[model samples]
Target: MDISKYIDYTLLSPTTTERNIIDLCHEAKKNKFYAVCVSSSYVALAKQLLEQTSIKVCSVIGFPLGSTATPSKVYEANQAISDGADEIDMVINLGFLKSKNYVSVLKDISDVKFAIGETPLKVIIEVSELNKNEIIKACEISLDAKVDYIKTSSGFSKGGATLTVVKIIKKTVKDSIKICASGGIDDIETVQKYIDIGVSRVCVSSDFNKKKQSI
Candidate 1:
């Protein structure tokens, strides 16, 4: 497989600077990776830097932590889209889900999806914090909300993507939605494994950064 096409060169750290995001976009262009994932604050810069290039600019909303209200997430998504973000990676309210508030979680995703219009939306479910049943429920919610992708983690979580979870997601969604595995993936082998299990995308941060020579 052309592994780079399945990767999103991610840089979501709180300390990530503009220079860093610029470098990340440049690297994505150079490597012909799928896209550059960054914080919402950098969406404008990332868009300008990657303009006219095949590389896409992706921004996050209600990121890392999904405790924010649905309106806030929708507003953030709209702003990012207006700033030229080609796709949105959002976090689901884990607390709401754990509280069995499935309606709120679904509304959170659907509202953002509506606000973005044609732009793709990927919902992050922070797999480490969930059990197998919870993961299944998340997939169900993403499908109901009509999100473009159901992501495994935010990488800030205690763990990252696993093949088993990806497989489960694949089975649960049944091609109704795409799956993105993030968090701890750090190499071509792990990325390939996730792809084999049905992850349409893999979020690569530390591993890609360490290989800056190629960038």
Candidate 2:
């Protein structure tokens, strides 16, 4: 299905080094992937490495765990933009969402959105931690916050993106906001499934290149 353009080649490990970011950028350029997703610390280096390419540099804010304060997330988002990130992927506060504090949840996303202005923002809902109802409510809040995309997972959770959860997100958001499916996606076939179900982006690790080669 030629899913390269739909990919956000990601490297978000805590131990990720400069050499790792260098290789990630190299792989993204070689594969013609859509973007390179990295931690904020490496955004500048990735941007500099891919300066001559169209591949966007995406930075994650309050990643994996969305428990960071809203003001902190806003600052991180702004700092990432200033560091040359073309897109921002922020994790949503699962604690607030599950506690029925919809106002805090909504404000958390909205504050970052407002801070980033025109830069694209993708809210990671960490679907594995949420039930069907929570998933729907998360989508509703993301839509209310007017985010550019609602991502499936942070790849650090108990589980990653699932078709069932993606279905719920699709049904809720429809065409209003795009969907980015991340976590445990390692093959073209799986990537094809998400694309078939209307996922606009898929986040995969460097190992994806090995899988693509074997195919």
Candidate 3:
């Protein structure tokens, strides 16, 4: 499979500089990765860098850790969309999920989705932090909030995407929402494996960024 179309070339590290984002866009444009996911602060720059191309600018909101207040996340997401982010990948409230506060979790995601309006929203649930039932419940809540995609991790957590978790998300969301398997997605084979099991997008970090140096 042409994994480029299914990959979201990602750079969401704290140490990512402006130059890194610029280079990321270049790689995304050249490789035709599905999109370039960057920190919300650099959405406009990446958007400008990849302008006129089919590549999209995906900005993260309340990223990595989703402990921020809901209003802040809403405002941040709206600002990102206005700043030219074609999509918003906001981290879910893990604390709420961990505490089994399903209602709050759904509300948090729904609020962010409301803020972004028509822009696509991907909720990063960080699967590694949750158990099997928790993961399924998170998926159900995300679907209830009508998220465009359910991402597997933030990559800063314990672990990243695994085939087992991916399958659970696929079966849980089914056709109601899409899945974006991120974190630890290493090579074309791993990317293809996620795609085979119905992942709509895979966020690539090391595999893509390291290869960018080769170019």
Error at 26, model 1, angstroms = 1.2
Candidate 1's TM-score reads 0.96
Give me the overall lDDT of model 2.
0.95
Q: How far does residue 77 in candidate 3 sit from its true spot (Å)?
A: 0.3
Model 2 TM: 0.99
Instruction: Please tell me which model should have the higher TM-score, number 1 or number 2.
Output: 2
Q: Pick the candidate with the highest lDDT.
A: 2
Candidate 1, 42-86: lDDT as tens digits: 999999998888888889999879999989998988888889899
Clashing pairs in 2: none
Ranking of all predicted structures according to lDDT, beginning with the best and ending with the worst: 2, 1, 3
All models: lDDT? 0.88, 0.95, 0.88
Which stretch of 10 consecutive residues in model 2 shows the poorest summed lDDT?
A: 206-215
Runs in model 3 lying further than 4 Å from the true structure:
209-215
RMSD of each: 1.6, 0.6, 1.6
